[model samples]
Target: MPVAVITGGGAGMGLAVATVLVADGWRVALLDVNSTVGEAAAASLNSNQIKDGSEAQSLFIRTDVTKYDDLRTAFATVADRWGGNIDFVFANAGIAGGTDFYNDSDSEPQQPSLLVEEICLRGVVFTSHLAMHYMRRNKPAPGGVIVSTASAASIYASPELPLYAAAKHGVLGLMRSMSLQLASEGIRVNSILPGAIRTTLHTKTIWDQFPVGDFTPVEEVVSTVLGLVNDPTATGRAMEISAGETFDRKQPDYCNETMQRIMQGKSY
Candidate 1:
């Protein structure tokens, strides 16, 4: 059976992706730091517990993506359980907390601290590295995919959450570079840049602060993720999901022109 591994699988978009994949007949291995939530998520998807029992087989492992050893162990466990073939890996673990640009007097440490870099950027890079290691070892199967959950912040910078924006931009670069590097290996690396998803992580106050009025539903994000998983032709691409809509990453003007010139073997 094809196997998929999802980091940050305990809650939010990660859990939603796991649930959708389980329904689609893919065995899932969930990795997250929150043991309680992770275990509960696994139980929710396990085929054995359901009456119809058609759900995909699932397991949970406590992991901290910031730690390489933890990610290594989690991948090993998944490999052992699923016979060494990882069909898909979703590096979706992330965190969001920072200082408010509008409020300089808001001396709360929760606002724009170093934690954003530690968890969001550094953690994502570590997670992607581990995923790449495992993906490189996997025997090529149809639809072999590696995806990371980035944010719309990658394209449109947000001054209020500068660190978060930088981290997500780094994620986009990671995906693009990995896509080029792994193409010959039959492993496709991509990213899903979600606009605004309603999850425990995003408070109502935050949404109100955003230029966009509300958070997009989790279901909409999950559907876009599933679509990427199902589409073999989508490689080195970033798919954006937001309130009932989905779009591809827009190429920069310079890059597009450069690509056109390169294709025609002529200077722009």
Candidate 2:
């Protein structure tokens, strides 16, 4: 059976993804900071194993992605549990950041919290770096797949949420760079940029503010994720999923001195 490691698997889209993967005959390792929710989610998934008869199981590992050591331990545990091969990784943990730059607050605007940067941007990088180590060893599985949860902010600027946008932009850059760097190793990296999904990430006030039918369902994002996981040719692609439509963002080619030097086989 294929093995998957998903960050932020305790709730929302993470749990939804884990449930689907378990039902589809994949053993999953869920990493979440909230041990209670993580364990409960795993139990819920396992409760259905009798119905699926796939004997699929889930392991919940309490992890704070902002900490590198936590990520290393989670990945190692997954590798050991699954016999040293990880078929897939989903780097999906993130926050919306501190107050938006343009929020309607009476208080003066403050800079984005360092915690937001650490979790949203640095956490994704650390997860991807760890994923490469295991994914490279996943032989006989046509290489391993990595899918990250970016956001629509990755492509378009959000003046209201400047730091959130910046963090997502960082995710895109990491995904694109690693996708090209790891292609030869058969490890494909891609990202999903979903628009306003009705997950725990949104508060009730945020949800109520949205027009009816404006927010994309969590299931829609889950379906897109499944598609990306199964598509062998997908790499370095950022898929934008909105309420009524979905599309891939076009990435530009690099043609700078760095590219020229790399093409000439010059070491950096």
Candidate 3:
């Protein structure tokens, strides 16, 4: 069976992906900060509870992705338990928080919170770094796929959550920068930018505010992720899944022939 590791696997899209993979005979480790949801999710995915002595088809490990030690240990445990080869990694752990930075009403200059970036951007970097290491341990060949959960904010503006938008943009940039290089090592890197989907991240009242076509279905996100994972030729791709449709957002074209030649150092 193929082995996979998923961050934020306790709920939402991560758990959904785990469910699909398990049904298809993939062994998975669910890493999440929430022990209760993580344990329950693992148990539910397994036919028999994976006691320490038994072969674990699905395992849950409490991990705070922002902490390197936590991420490193979680990946190591999965590699050690699953025959030392990791086939896929989903750096899907993220959180949403924003503050009004321009506010002048504060009596004191309060420290701005960067928790969103810490979890979304930094976490993905940490997870993918470890992913490459263990995936290179594959016995016969070194190969794996990595996908990070970016957001619609990655490409467009989210005036409501500027910090979150910036963090997601970093995720997109990180994927694009690494994908081309990792392809040489038999690894594929990609990012999934999802529009609003009703999940545990926020209440229904908040999500409901989106107009009709603005809210996307979680099922679409799942399919987009699996499509990228299975497509051998896909790398350095940004898949935007929203409102039951998929689109590829390629890098913008050069401004002009002269600039293109100058920047690319080659003919247009």
CA RMSD, predictions in order:
4.3, 3.3, 3.4
Q: Which sections of candidate 2 miss by over 4 Å?
A: 50-52, 100-112, 140-142, 253-268
| Candidate number with the higher TM-score (2 or 3) | 3
- Pairs that collide in candidate 2 are none
TM-score of each: 0.84, 0.89, 0.91
lDDT per model vs. reference:
0.80, 0.87, 0.88
Better of 2 and 3 by lDDT: 3
lDDT, candidate 2, 1-268, per-residue tens: 8899999999988899988999888989999999999999998888786345656699999999999999999999988878889988999998883464455657876764567678789989999999999988776654798999999999998876788888899999899888988888899999999998877786788779989788888888899899989998999889999996889997866589898778546897
Model 2 RMSD vs true structure:
3.3
Q: Model 1 clash pairs? A: 98-111, 98-112, 99-111, 99-112
Local lDDT at 122 for model 1: 76
Residue 114 error for model 3, in Å?
0.7
Q: Which segments of candidate 3 are over 4 A away from where they belong?
A: 48-56, 211-213, 256-268
For model 3, how does the per-residue alpha-carbon lDDT over 1-268 read when each residue is reduced to its tens digit?
Answer: 7898999999999999998888777899999999999999999898643334344499999999999999999988988887899999999999885466555664887767778889999999999999989877787899899999999899999998888999999999899878867889999999999988878877777877888688788888888899999999989889998888898999788787897677545664
